[model samples]
Target: MARLTILLVVLVAAMATAFAPVPLSRTVSTTALNGQTRVEVKIGEGEPIESALRRFKREVNKSGHLMDLRHKRYFENSQDRKKRKIVQARIRKRLERMNARRMRQRRS
Candidate 1:
């Protein structure tokens, strides 16, 4: 009788598990660079592969890993680095001024 009850319990548990809603599985992959940056994307069970690839590319671009890698590919001295930073700052300031002027003109 005990063996029969055990078998029944097992059978009920199996049925319950079989009927339970199964979650959609996702595939994830991560690429790490220098142990500092990682880009990851998950593809759902029904999601299109093209969409998943697009999402991965977007994530990579958004993370700036490619840019960082490019910048670090070559060695730059302190003076060169400082010059580059100054040029970037000047460009940023110019853009900000242009934007502010546009806003002021729009207000008029």
Candidate 2:
């Protein structure tokens, strides 16, 4: 009886997963100067195209492919790349400091 019950439970779980509804994913491929990258977004059944497009844009931004493509569009010398990185780091640090100051003021 115990084995039969366990088998029935396992069978039910398998069937449930097998019949589960999976969202359809659409892939958008972008070709960069270096190579190609793909971003995928899932669209649920009956979902509107506008929302799906928004989701796709979010995914692409999160993946950094668009920014990467822009960066790769131009060839930068090593010295220029290093200078850009330094400037970015400085800006990032300044923003972090500003945020910290804001947090301190809020606590007070």
Q: Pick the candidate with the highest lDDT.
A: 1
Q: What is candidate 2's lDDT per residue for 1-108, written digit by digit as tens?
A: 999999999889888855665546554444445476777666767889898899888878977877877877999889988998999899999999999999999999
Query: Counting only residues 3 or more apart in sequence or on different chains, how many pairs clash (N, Cα, C under 3 Å) in candidate 1?
Result: 0
| Candidate 2 whole-model C-alpha lDDT, 0 to 1 | 0.79
For this target, which candidate reaches the highest TM-score against the unseen true structure? 2
- For model 1, the local distance difference test gives 0.80
- Residue-level lDDT of model 1, residues 1-108, one tens digit each, is 999999999889888855666545343445666777777676777889898888889878887878878878999889988998899899999999999999999999
lDDT to native, each model = 0.80, 0.79
Worst 10 residues of 2 by lDDT: 25-34
Q: Worst ten-residue run, lDDT, model 1? A: 21-30
Q: What's each prediction's TM-score? A: 0.54, 0.60
The per-residue C-alpha lDDT of model 2 at residue 43 equals 73
As a whole number from 0 to 100, the lDDT of residue 70 in candidate 1 is 84
lDDT of 1 at 6: 100
Clashing pairs in 1: none
